[model samples]
Structure formats: structure tokens, C-alpha cells
Target chain A: MKTSYHKLKNFINTPFGVILLVAAVVFGVEVLVMEFLFVFVPVIQASVPPIAFNFLDAVILTLAVSPALYFLIYQRIHADAEKLRKITESAQDAIIVMDNHGRVSFWNEAAETIFGYTKTEAIGKELHKLIAPEKSLNAFNHNFKGFQETGEGPILESVREVMALRKGGEEFPAELAVSALPINGTWHSVGIVRDITARKKRENLLRERERELTEVNEYLRNKEAKEQALLASLGEGMISTEIGGEIITINRVAEEMLGWKEAELVGKKLIEAIPAISETGNIIPPENRVCLNVTAGACVGPLTDDTSAFVKKNGESVPVAITTTPVIIGGKCSGAVIIFRDITNEKELEKTRRDLLSLASHQLRTPLSGTKWLIETLQREIHGTLTEKQGEYLTQIYKINERMTNLVHDMLGVLRMEGDINPAKIEPVSIQTLFGVITETLGNVAKEKNITLEISKTAESSIDTDSLLLRNILECLISNAINYSNEGGAVLVETKRDGADIVFSVKDSGIGIPADEQRQIFQRFYRATNAKTFDTKGTGLGLYIAATLAKKIGAKLTFESAEDAGTTFFLRLPASAK
Target chain B: MNHVLIVEDEDFLVRALKDNLVSEGHSVAVAMDGEAVFDELKKKKPNLILLDLLLPKKNGFDVLKEIRQSPEWQLIPVVILSNLGEDSEIKKALELGANDYFVKSQHPIQEVIEKVREYLEGKGSTKVGL
Candidate 1:
């Protein structure tokens, strides 16, 4: 019906409908004039008296013409409506038309699909009642009434996302655009709607991704700031460079250490800016530079090559110990960091200390030795036979001198042990000859104590060691054994060959080291709590010196003891190949 | 009787040692320096040498080296007695063929007498000091 009506509407709208209406009106008026003339002629007044009384024919003609004119007008109006329907049907939006009475006058194919109401069922129903949400129905009714009265509505021609109901009674977001169209001197509304649920979901996902990206970017910024702060706050000189050895950053300590400002050193090659100079005043080559080695994925320790110094900007050299590490990421060296400490003052202090120690040993011992010899000469009764009282005083003097000598001697030994000693003079030493010397030195003391001192050598092979150092160690251990043991307690000194090592052990039947104080026995100046009550003269440096000396000579000292029983100390030296 | 040479610069120490050695029935000669030791050696070969390390003009180590330079004097045993009793110095003296070492103040005069007697007894033993 719509297709047929549109064809006729197009024909009338052009020229056919205009000409047909004009011709019908003109023909009706001409017929009326002819009939009036025929009825009003004088010569036929009497003959046509029945004709003048033919008003029924005129009334019948008027009724038939009026009904025909109304049919023509209705057909033309239907044709115009079909043309508007065609425009609305092809649009993507659901086009809904409602008349002045606020009832649904037209629901296009899109409107039927969007709202789930057929055109037949939707027509004559209020438009807002069909699709408006219950929450918005009151507002919609007020706006619709205003629209009908003034041809104005709040949403007219305004596109917005609105909650819309579908035919399945489900609600979804939609984009609605509304406008008023006038026809027959009354206003109708055309509402264009589009489903926007899919668009809204896409927009939401995009917003979430944007937020995540911003958070990640912010976190990275904060981490970078924290790293920068840490690098700037370090106490040791720190220099960082790109993988190519170009200087990228230098901390405040590095600037002060090198005597170059950060701005002056940045972008310069690390090796070029701060040269690694040897103490002998030679510039080191690049391949030998510690930072470059780190950049090449090498883990290099403190580079004190030739007592290395880092030459500063003003041509002064500062002795330093440099250590470099690579900043590795994914198995690649992205950069390198070098940390160095200035040791000039420390080195100077160390040298001064060594000098003072050497002086003390040489100068102080000379006079002390002279005093001891002079006192010993008197005690030998070379001056005369002394009275008992004089003899006792002389003996006291002798003991005091002896104690002083031992203290000075042990103090000097500690100095030497702590400092560098020349490597032990390794030589062939016979255990038989060695023990002979030890026994000869310690036997009288052992005899006085009534402690049987025993010696046994089980190894047939000759042992190699620094004989003097070995003698000192054995002397300390044997003397300690004698000193700590009760009268009549025996001391056993033995030597044997363990696999790859020669084990020399000193076992004593004496007061054992207190369990709690055992670990601290090797520390300098540490005395066992038990020793304080024994009235024995102990330097408290015996075991410390013994242990350190043993270590220097590549030996291990291990001991075992039980309280009130006895203690055994073992010195294990590497069995040397002849 | 053993003839002993006391090569030392200290007169009191020399006099005391000489008195002790004389009482012990050994003839003792005095050399105050390394040069004096050479002069004394030329005058009469001693049976034993008691060498002091820190002597005037020339030390005992040089005197000992000079004495060891000749086979005639090298056979004579020398005992080094000194206040410099550090292991390095002691090892050095022993390495240069001194018979034995004793610290001057560490031991009493009796111990010194004992060490001198041992060397005096082995005057011509000819065993190398090392």
C-alpha cells in the first residue's frame, strides 16, 4: 500500500494532481451557471413551473460532488504520508513519529526493530508510555505535553545517551536525537535513536588501559628518582659510565675525590677524564683500566696495580683502591660503576707506625738488654757473696728484669706478626734435632715442675719448615703447657705425618681452658678466667702470637680441652716435598 | 787452657768478662773493635772468640766475616753474644757461620760462661756452624 500510495503522491505533487483539481472545480461552476440560466427563462415560466420546483435534483447534485471532493483530498494526504515514511524507513536510527495528541502516529521499520512494538500495536498508543523507563515516565509526560502545546521539548534535536528499553524488556544505552515536524497545522515529533552499548564498553576498556599506562609510567619515574638519590648520597667515590666507557654520571664523592666538578666530567670518557696513574708516574693503558674491564663484562676486584693512584684534574695524584662492577641486565653489560677510596692519609699513617715500631724495637731493647745483663752479672755473685736479704732482693730484681724482657720481646713479636714478615725461610729440619733443642731449653723448667716431659718423632721422612719459626711456636706451646699444668703433671710433645701434612701436637695434663673463654683465647690480651687465680706470669699474647705465626707459615692450630682435665694443641703444617 | 778473645767496645763488660774468664782459668784477650779484633788475631790466634754485635767502628758481624775469610781462623769457634736478639739478626749471624747466638741481657752471666765453655771445649771440632 505504501509503494502504490507513494507512486500516486509523486504524480499529484508534480503537475497531475494540481490540473485535475482545477478542472473539476471549473466544470462544477459552469454546470451550476447553465442550470440557473435554464431555470430562470420568462417565456417558459408557466411551462417550467414544475422545473422551478426541481430543488431535489439540485440538492442531490450538491451531496454527490461534496463526497467526491473529500475522497480526492484524502488520497492526496495518504500519498504525502507515504513519501515521509519512505525517508524514515531508510535511516539507520529508529525514527518514531508521534502526532499532536502525543499518540504514536508513525513507527518506521527501525522503530519496530528498536522498541519491539509492531506499527499496528504501537499506533494510537502514547509514545512515552510505549518506551519510556518507569523512573522517567513522569518527566517524559510533562515534556511531551509541553511539546504538544508549544512545539518545544527539552530533548528536541538534542542528541544524548539515554537508557532505552528493548522489545525483550531489557534496558540498554542509546543515542537519541529528537526533532518536531509540522503537518496539517499540528506538530509531530521524530525521534532518531542508536544503540550505544557496544561503544560504551569500548570506551570503558580504553579508559582502563590509559590508567594502567599512567601508573606504570609514574612508578618508573619514582624508581629513577630514588636511584638518583641513592647514587648521590654514597660516601665512597662512585663513577658510572655507559657501556661504551663514556662517562654518564659521577656522584659528589667522585667529584671531590677526583677534584673535578660533575659538569666538567660528564660526557668525557671515564678513563680519559680521570687517568689511572701508577705511583711511578706512568699513565695506564685503556685495556688495563678497571672500569673498561667492567664494561667488557669482566668482574674486576680492587685495582691497586703498582700502588695505583688516580691523578686529579690539577695534576696531583691520589692513591686509591678502585673496584668496578658491571650493571648487567638480561646478560648484557648496560653500564659499569667504579667505586674508589682515597688512601693517601691511611697509607701515610701506616708507614709512620711501621717506622715507630722499628725504632722502638731497636732502641728500647738495647738499653733493656744492657740492664738485664748488668743485673745478671750481679746476681751471679761475681761482686761478692751476698747476705740472705741482699740475695732475696737480687732475686726479685732478676725476676722483674726477666718479666720486662719477656714483655718487650713478645710485644715486638706481635708487631712483626701483625705487620708483614718475610716469607718463612723454608729449609730441611730434622724432628730429632728440633726436639733436642726444645727439650734442652725447656727440660730444666719441666724438671723443676716434676712434670715428665716426653718427645717422640714417628715420621721417618725429613720435615721442611722455617726452623726458627717452628722453634718459636713449639717454645710458646711447651712453655704454656709447663706454666698452666699443676706440679707433677706430664707434658707430651709428639710429631707425626698425616696425609699431606705434618702434625705436631703439645698435650699437657693441666688446668684446661674454661669452656666459655676458649674461643677468645686466640685474641690478643685475652686471658682465661682460670689463669688469673694461678699466680703465673702470662703475657696473654702467647696463643695469639702463636696462632698468627702459625697461620703466616701456612699451618693450622687446633686444640681440645676439658675443664680441670688437660689441653692438647695441634700445629698442622703442610708436608713439603723435598 | 783455652785462649778466648772478647771483641767488644764496652770496657766494663770487657773487664767483667775478662775477670770471669781468668777466674775460670782461661786466658782472655780483648779487642775493642773489628779492626782491633783483626790486630789481636794477627798477634795471636785465640782458641775461642766471644763476638759482640754492636761494636765501635766495625760491628761483630764484619769481624766474624773477616775471621771466617781465613781457613786458619775459620776453624776457631765463635759464639755471638748481643743485645740485638731479633730472629732476623740471629738468623743472619747463624747463616754467616757463627757457632751459636745468645742475647746479652736475656740470660745471666752464668749462661754466658756455659756457652763460652762449650765453644772453648770444641775449639778445633771443625764442624761448620750451620
Candidate 2:
């Protein structure tokens, strides 16, 4: 949909185009009519006026009209020259017209302004001599001779640039276009000149800017490629995530660490990609996620506190020391980088250390036991009967020997717990039956002190516990009670169901631990001053070993006592379901 | 008197055990390691064997494996007396056809001798992998 206004705009944009088209059509029609007239006149000449008469008539007519017609044509030519002069004077480009004799006929105002010559000084003068450089004057004259013959030379037929000199003898760049016109049977050449010095300067500046831009682009590309190569070649696993904890980039080591391809984990939330589970096989709480902490702008170092393992895509756990740092950009946290390494080999080496310890302990025990047996068999008179004083000395030897044995046993037991061995086999266990076995095992020892061991239970139900470990726990508690109790004192073993747990208490009427020493009772080899004095023969590892074994079996062992008051040690273990 | 074979590496322990076993009225033979034990077994068959686990040459498990695999020696009673008291080790020894298992440090000479006498009388029994 073109409006009338748009049509007028098109016509104005190409103002000279329509005029040239109309001139071209009129010229074509005139040439055709001339050809037709020439042919018809030749054929009809006999019937028409005689050739000589016609020639005389034409000559007379031409002679009559010559002066008047010449005046009229001269007036018209002068008017057209005036019109061309006005047009050329207002144009931005310089216009110079020269006759075939190489003499300048006309110079427009622009030509005068450009060449520093007035029209009076330029007209009727040689054009080459006025404007051409001294060095180009000979070539310009040579080309001018050829141009007159054919009107087909470089300067006459087409646009071209030539060395041009100004009035001050200075040379500058210029754009020149030349065309030939036949006016009154002579070839006249016109040149349009545009000074291009400012255009050339601007073009050079643009080229310099483009070169600098290209070099800067190359430098940035190389820097980015070097950084990427460095990240890829690292041995420590590196994962860079967005500020929201979504994974954005992963290095080669990170792919191996997480057991996933980069495409599988990138753009996905880190927590979802590598689900960090605690050693207890439960998901770590969101607050504990190192990735999330870094995303919140907190710096984190390698975490060595709680054991955390990552769940791989294959559902296997890989222990790791995960640390993260925020990738800060302009004082704002844009993302975070997580670096980690697999700890499997470290874990294996730790196990090897434990196994080594066990091996050394095993070797140490054999000789220690041999010494014990040697001392015992000699004292018992199995090899020889001991005298009364020898018996007294042997008693001391037996006590010391027993203490060493207990210490070794306790040390080994603690090591086993540290090494995570001897797992509990949970089953229904009867407190009544355990009490029976304890009595049968330690009854004679209790009898030596006239201690009465009694058992009372409100209910008889088995608990979920390792039978042997529970037996050892009871044996430690009741024996400890009996040994610490006064002669003729009663030691009570009580058991009852308390909600989800079974509470078993070994209450002893004994010389109790001091209030000051109660706090230190659970520590290994710790002894109360009074107990150390009262019983010259105790390892003081009874409670420590009991407490440790209880923890190993997921039980709670607690106690309450006062100085010289009866102490009660309670063992609460989770009861089995019906 | 019943004949007993004692396979132990500890010099002091071997002396003490020999003394105790001699006093208990049982004839005793000694093997310093698993290889010696096998060689001694081929030379002379004892009524019972007290095999220590940690050996200098072949380990006790390999020796036990050999004993259980052989037709003539499979039925002979083997009592493992080891200082390595870990349950997994004990389980492995029993699974390899041990008649009984004992930690030397945990047992008195009298208890060990009593065990040796019981096995010598052909009364020894194992609860599993018999």
C-alpha cells in the first residue's frame, strides 16, 4: 500500500532519472524520422524541384535565415551556457570544460575555488598548463592529443584520478570524473573533481581500530583456553556450581570422583547429583552440605569432623574430604568450586594399621600368658610346694600378674571397638538365664566374702542384644559389686522393662567410689583414692570396659553412687519386639 | 599314656607346655612350624594335635587345609591354640576342620591339659563343620 506521498518521494529521490529517460526517448524518435526523410527525398527528387534549384532554394533560404537564425541560435546557446554555468557554480565538485585544442573554455566557481584560479584567468588558457603538476604536464599533453582524435581516452571517456596541483604548489588526493560533449561540432571535455583527503584519513583510523580489536580478541581467547586446560589437568576433583548450588562445570577428576559423566551432572543441583550420606547411611542435613554453605558465601576447608561419604551413581559409597570455596566476582558470590579426593586408600591404610596392631598384640599375649602360667603352676605346688613366706610373696606376684592381664585385655578390647569389629548379633536374651550363668561362674568368689547375690525382676522378657557381650557386661557389674561390698553385705541384681528399653541394675552394698572420683569413673585406668586404697588389687578398667562395650552394642550404661554409700550401675538395652 | 602333638613357635611356651604335659602323664611331640608339623605327622601319627595358628613357614590355615583334604589325616582331632583371638580368625580355623579353638593367653595350663586329655580319649566334638 503506497500512498501518493510515497510516490512523490520516489520521484524526488531520482529527480534527474526521469528527465534523462525522456531525453533518450525523444532522441531515438528523431533519429528514426531523419532516416525516413533521407530515404524519401532521394526517391522523389525527380518529381519534386530539381536538385540544383532545391539546392539554390535551400541555399537562399539558409542565407536568408542565416543571420536571423544565427542570432536566434546564438541567443539560445548563450542562454543554455548561462544555465550550465549556474548549475556548475552551485555544485560541490569542481567543473572544468576544455576545447579539443587543450585550451580551457569555461571554469565554474568550484573549479576556481579548488584550483585557486579565477574564471578570467582560466578561460582561453591551456588547462594542463594551469592545473597539471609540472611532472605530469608532458603526459597530460600527450593524452590530450589522443583524446582529440578519438574522444575515447581515459580522462575523456571515464572517471579517473590524476595528480593535481593547487595554486600554492601543494598536491592532495582528489576524485576526478571526465566526460566528452560535442557542442557546435567540437569535442569539449568536462572534469568533476572531489578532494578525498578527509575520507582517506577516516578510512585509516577505522583500519587501525579494527586491527587493535582483533588482537584483543585473540588475547582473550588464549587466556580462556589456558584456564580450561589447567582445570582439566588437575588431579583433585573440581566441580564449579552456580550460586544456587547447581552444578555448572566439572573437571576430569571430578567426573571420576563422582562416577558420572560431565553431561550427566552439569546443570543439575550438586546435592542431587552426589547425594552425601553420613556414615550411618542417612542423608546429611541441608545445613551440613558444604556446597550449600559455599553458595551462601561461606568459606569452607576440608571437613574432618563427621565421616561423610558420597553416593555414586552405581549406588556405591566413596568416602571423601570435600571442601568448597565461592567463586567471587566483583564482590558478589557468582558460584562455588568444590574440590575433593577419594579417601578409600587412606581408609585401607588405617585398617592395615589396625591389623598390624592386632598382630603385635597377639604376639605379645603369648609370652605374657606363659609368664602367668609359670608363676601360677609354681605357686600351686604343681611343680613344687611353696613355703608360707613364699606363698605370701607369690600372692603379690599373682595380683601383679592379674593386673597386667586385665590391662592387656582392656586395651585389646578398646582397640577392637576402634577398629569396628565384633559386631553384635541381636537376638532375644533372658536376664534370668544370664543371672544364673553369672552366679555359676562367680558364685565361689562371692562366697569367699560372704556376699549374697540376689536377683529380682518385675518381668521376664528377652532383650535384643549380643548374648556374649551382655554376659560379659553383667559379669563385670556383679563381680565388681561383690568385690567392693563389705563382708556379709547383700548384692542385688534387678531387671525391669522400661518402655522400649530393659534396665538392669547391679546394686551393691559396698565401699562406694568417692563423689570426686565419680566423674572420672568411666575413664580407662582411672581409680578413686579410696577404692585404690581399699582394694589393692583392681585394674579400675571395669566400668570403662563396661561402658565401652555397652556403646558398641547400642546400649546405655549409667550409674549413681555416693562416698561409702551403695552404688547402683544400671544397664539399659533396647528390648526385642514381640 | 596318650600321645599328643604340640605345634608351637614360642620357645618359652613350648618348654612350659612340655613340662605341664609330661607331668599330666601324656607323651608329647613338638613341631616348630606348619611345615615341621606336617613332616612330623607323616613320620608319626599322634592321638591328638595342638596346632598354633601363627607359624613361621606355612601358616596354620594352609596346614589345616592340607590336613582336612588328606583322607588318612582328616579324621585325626586338631585343637587350635593361638594367641590371635579375633573371632574371624577363630571362625576360619574352625571352618577348616578344627576340633576346638582356644586362645593360649586365656587358658591356664591345667585347662589346656584337661582339653588335651578329653580329645585324646576320643570324646572331643565340634558343633559345626564336623
Candidate 3:
């Protein structure tokens, strides 16, 4: 009740309430005046009767209040309409009022700006025909027919997005909202239209970015799958680890070889998960592990070894030829990749080869030895004296036998060196003693060739190396030098200290190697063209055997030669062999 | 005269060795295989035994082991003359108490006689020739 009283009090203070109150007071005063005249003025009241007097008073009251009511209510309503017009004109959206006939009845300032028309030009124009695209006009006309008849249509009182034509005849996306209004019993539509071209551009750009992101994602997934397939298809057991030797991936071969699942080994330190053992059956420590060493950046080269074995999950050791390479990225060691193969079959094959070679050597040497003793017996003339012609024939046979013996020895030496079965036995070797032994071994050959063999020592140094291997290499070099020398040509076997290495060079003033054939001189069974022609009985395996032995003892065998001039072969050995 | 026993499978090598030893003024006994070695040893204790590794009946390693184990034959010098020239085989022969190890193809009959003379004269205990 209190709130209603307050509201009534507030309403009475309004202009319309004041006008109503004044009209009501004026009617009451007119009624009181009519009553006084009827009661006091007897002559007038008798001539005009009571009803006529009341009607006269009502006429005078109406005439007095008419102008006041019009002044107050009409002026207030006009002011309100003007305020609404100002608001509509100042809006950013185009505001238009369309009459029931579909013609623009009211055009605001925004509408003129949006439609490229002055208010006078737009006011009487058909709104849809003027602004709607040609494609949309049919639909607009169909909907407008219903609106014209009932002031209601499917598009009325709803927001919709439509293509609109700008002043320049360019179509742009726009948001439109229409509301119906009744003025003087005629339906008019108030429309709010907003240009949405910028919004639509933003949406299109967003969609384009989304599609690109999806494509990039697909490409990455494909690359990852390809890498996975490559890893899976590898024949060797492969393991990839992080910088700390933690296993990141293990391929199917590695899993099967190690008897461990990928999930079981991943994230575990490789050294701990699969222990490596040396040939002597001692566990290789973590710091000595090739993968860890590579990951720690301590090792730059790929470390490979065939004697190492990895202990499987079942405690069985499998011999493997393993190579561990660092995965370097941007000059930094990121991780390590270990590729290995089960070399058990290879080892067995090598053993078989070695056995076969050994057996062949023994079998061939037995018959050769028998022949050698028989020839020696004949040369010694134990049974009977030999004639001069017979002696010459025996000498020829001896030479051929000697050549056969040398060939057999060279072949055996090559087999031993190639197999790497005979490890170097390091000992202190006197350079002078080595030279003396080599010269003596080749002295007979040099004498037969009429070549002068000389041994000169610049610096007498004892080198720690395998005596047998060094002897074999020097003997080969000295013999080659002597055999290739021209008659009476001098061959020099010299040794000196070159830095921390022992340099043994055999210089011969004989047919030098051709420049093109020098590279292939160290290959097995390769004889220089001139050397072959000069000595048809040359085995062609001397330098190859020498090089193989040199390599076994950590020596570098190099040479410099000029065709028809001379060739000098240098064997450089570290003072303390590794 | 020092009696030298030639234990070899090859007829030519044995003949040459016997000739060389006999020419050097030593009586020669022949054992063509590992079994003949013991038969000859049982009949007469040779001053020195020339052993061949790859024998017909038994290998030289087992023959040498048995010779060294026997008190009567242990005193006799055993020399290995074999075509098997690998270091391991040589080492095995020497480790079995052979007085000397020589790869037969790598040594001439004269060198074998020289070695035999050195042993018979009590001038050499152990020697390896390849």
C-alpha cells in the first residue's frame, strides 16, 4: 500500500497528471457555477430551465480548457518525438522505417550514409528494391506480401544475415534485425542493419589457419610413422638412447636379440639393462661402454668391436659385432645409436676358414718338404756324382722349388694376417738386429740378382713391437728391393728415428712402380707391369703380405715411386706400439 | 754311436732323415706312426726321439705326454718334427717336455741333424725352429 501511494504521488507530479487534474477541477467549478445561477437568478433560471443552464456552463468550461490541454500534451508529445528522432539519427547502424506498402517511410542519417541517398531520396523509395541484392529480391518480395497484408511475416521480429548491396553496388555481408511497429493503424518495419564484412574475413582467415595446422599435424604424423617403419625394417639390432644413455627406443631385432620387450628396456640405462662382456668374460664397466662414451661426448668416432658380447636377459652371452655412433645435432652430441649384429655365425665361419687354411698349409707343406729333402739329397750327390749338364738341370729344378716354397709361405702369411688370429707379441726389437736379420735373409737373392744390398742405420733405437711381424715385413721389403733392382744396382735398407716413430725405408734403384699402379701395389697378387716382366717368377704377394703385417703391428706402410727411376717404400712404426 | 729314432709318417721324409742321421754316424731307428714309437721304444731306448705331430695312430701331444710320464723314457730327449706350424701347436709340443720343436717344411734335413747332434752331445736342452 505504501509503494502504491508513493507511485501515485510520483504520477501526479507529471505533466499529463497536472493536465488531467486541471480539467477535472474546471468541470467541477463549471457545475458549481451552474447550480448557483439556477438557485439565485430566478428570472434567468425560469427562462433557461435546469438542463439548458447546465449545458451552457459545460460549453463555456470546454472552451476555456481546450487550448490549455492542447498546449500542454501536444508540446510534450512533440518534444518526445524529437528526442527519439535524434537518437535514431545518431545510431551507428542504419535505422529505417518501412510502410505497409514496402516503401521507406522514414530514413535516418545513418540510412542515408549506408544507402548513398539523401533522406528525401530514400524516404519514398522501395526499401527492398533499393538495397536488397537481385538474387535476394525474389525472396524479399514473397515475404513482404504477407507482411503487407497482416503486419507479420517469417522475417519480421528476427535477426538474419544477408548479402546487401553497398552504395557503390558492391555486395557485402550484413546482419539485419527487423521489428514491426503500428503508427496510425498502419504497420511500419524498423530495421537495424550492420556491415559484417570484417567479421566474415576474420572467420575465413581462422578457418584457413585451422586447415594449415591440420596439414602440418598430418605431415608430422606421417614422418614419425615412416621413421618407425624404417627402424622396424632394419636387419641389425638397433637401440637408440638419450644423452644420459637412457634407452629411448629399441627395434624389433634388438628386442628379440636381447630377449627384452621395448617397454621393459625403455627409460632404463642401456649399460644397466644389457651388460657387455669382453672376450675374457669380464663385465665392461659403465664408463667403458661405447654408447655411454659417445653420449658423454668423450668419443667422436664410431666405436666398433667384434670380440664384445652382450649378456642376454636369459644370462646367455651372444657374440656381436657392434658399432655405436653418436647422434650429433648442431655440433652437439645429443644421444647415441647402437647398431649391432649377432656375429656368432661369422665367428664360426671364420674359424672354419682358419681351420681349412691351416689344414691346406700343413698338407701342401708336407709334400713340398718331401720334395725339398729329395732334391737336397740329389744336389748333395749322396747316391752318385752329377754331370755338369745334370747339375745345371738340378739347379733349375731347385730354383723352381724355391719359388714354390716362397709362394706357399706367402700364402700362409696372408691367411694368418687376414684372419688376425695371430696377435702381435710385443717385445723390444733392436733396429740393428732387425736390419742384420733382414739383410742376411735377402743376401742370397741380392747376390743372385747381382744387386748390392746395404743396411745403414742413422739412429740406433730399439722399438717395442712384435718381433716376428716386424721381421716378416722387413724381409719382404728388402727382398722386393733386391729382386726389382737392376744388375749391380744398389739397394739400401735404412732405419732412423722420425719423431716418436721408427722409420724403416727400403730404397731400390730399380724399375719403379707406374704412377697409376702404385695405388694397387698393396693389393694381393698385384705385380707391377715392369716388375712382372723383369721377374716372371715373382709371386706378387710380397708387398700385400708386408702391408698386412705392418697394419697388424700398428705401422704405416707408404711409398714414393717414379716409373723407371726408383721406388722407396717406407714402414713407419710407433716407438711404443699400440 | 748315438742311436736316433725317426718317427715320421711320410716315407720320403723318414728316409731322408734316416740317411742324414746315419751319415752323421748315428744308428737310426724308424717309427712310422705313434704306435710304432712305443714298440720301438720298448725294444730299444733310443738316445733321442724325433716325433711327428700328425701321426696315424695317436697325435704327437699324447705320445709326448706318455713318453714324459714313463720313468724309463722320460730321460730320453724327445724332438718334435711336424708340418703343423701354428704357434699354439708348437707351444703345446714344447709344453709337453719335447726337447725341441721344428716345423719340418720350414727346416731342412741338415738342420734336423744339427739339432740332433746338439741334443746327443748334451749341448742343447730346448730349441724352437720354424
Candidate with top TM-score is 3
Instruction: For residues B1-130, write the lDDT of model 3, one tens digit per residue.
Output: 9988888999999888877777678998999988889999988889999999889989889999999999889989988888887777877888888888877776667677788889999997664422
Residues B13-114 of candidate 2: C-alpha lDDT, one tens digit per residue: 887778888888888899998899877888788888888888999899999999999998898899898888776788899988898887777666777778
Enumerate residue pairs that collide in model 1. A157-A178
Cα lDDT, all candidates: 0.78, 0.78, 0.83
Ordered list by TM-score, greatest first:
3, 1, 2
Compute the lDDT of residue A154 as modeled in candidate 3.
83
Tell me the TM-score that candidate 2 gets on chain A alone.
0.49
lDDT of candidate 3 at residue A42, scale 0 to 100: 69
Of candidate 3 chain A, the 10-residue stretch with the lowest lDDT total is A48-57
lDDT of 1 by residue, B3-109 (tens): 89988777667766776788789988999987888888888899889998888889888878878888879978888877775566777888777887876655666
- Give fnat of each prediction, in order: 0.34, 0.44, 0.48
Instruction: Give the per-residue lDDT digits (tens) of candidate 2, residues A1-578.
Output: 33455445545335244444444454455555556666666687756532322344444444454556446656876899789878988998888888888889878888888888899988999888888888988777777777776566755556666668788888867788889855443457888888766776787888988898888989889988998999998878888888888889899987887789999988888887788888778888777775677755564533232268888888888888777777888977788888888887877877797787669768678877788777666765767778999989877876777667767776777666666633578888766777777786678778878999888755766777888788878888998899889899999988887888788999997999788778899998898888887776677787887888898788899898987898999999878744
Per-residue lDDT over A1-578 for candidate 3, one digit per residue giving the tens place of the 0 to 100 score: 85466457656656667666667777777878777877777666667654446576596776688567758766888899899999998998889889888899988888777778788888888988888899999888888877765578788778999998877788888899998866544567999988788989999999999999999999999999999899999999999888888899999999999899999999998899999998889999988876667756554759877788999999999999889898888988888999999998888888898798779888988988888787777777776899999989987886677678778888887777787754688999877777766664567668778888888756666899998789888888887888888899999878888788888899999899999898999998999899888877688899998898888899999999999899999999888865
Q: What is the lDDT of residue A283 in candidate 3?
A: 96
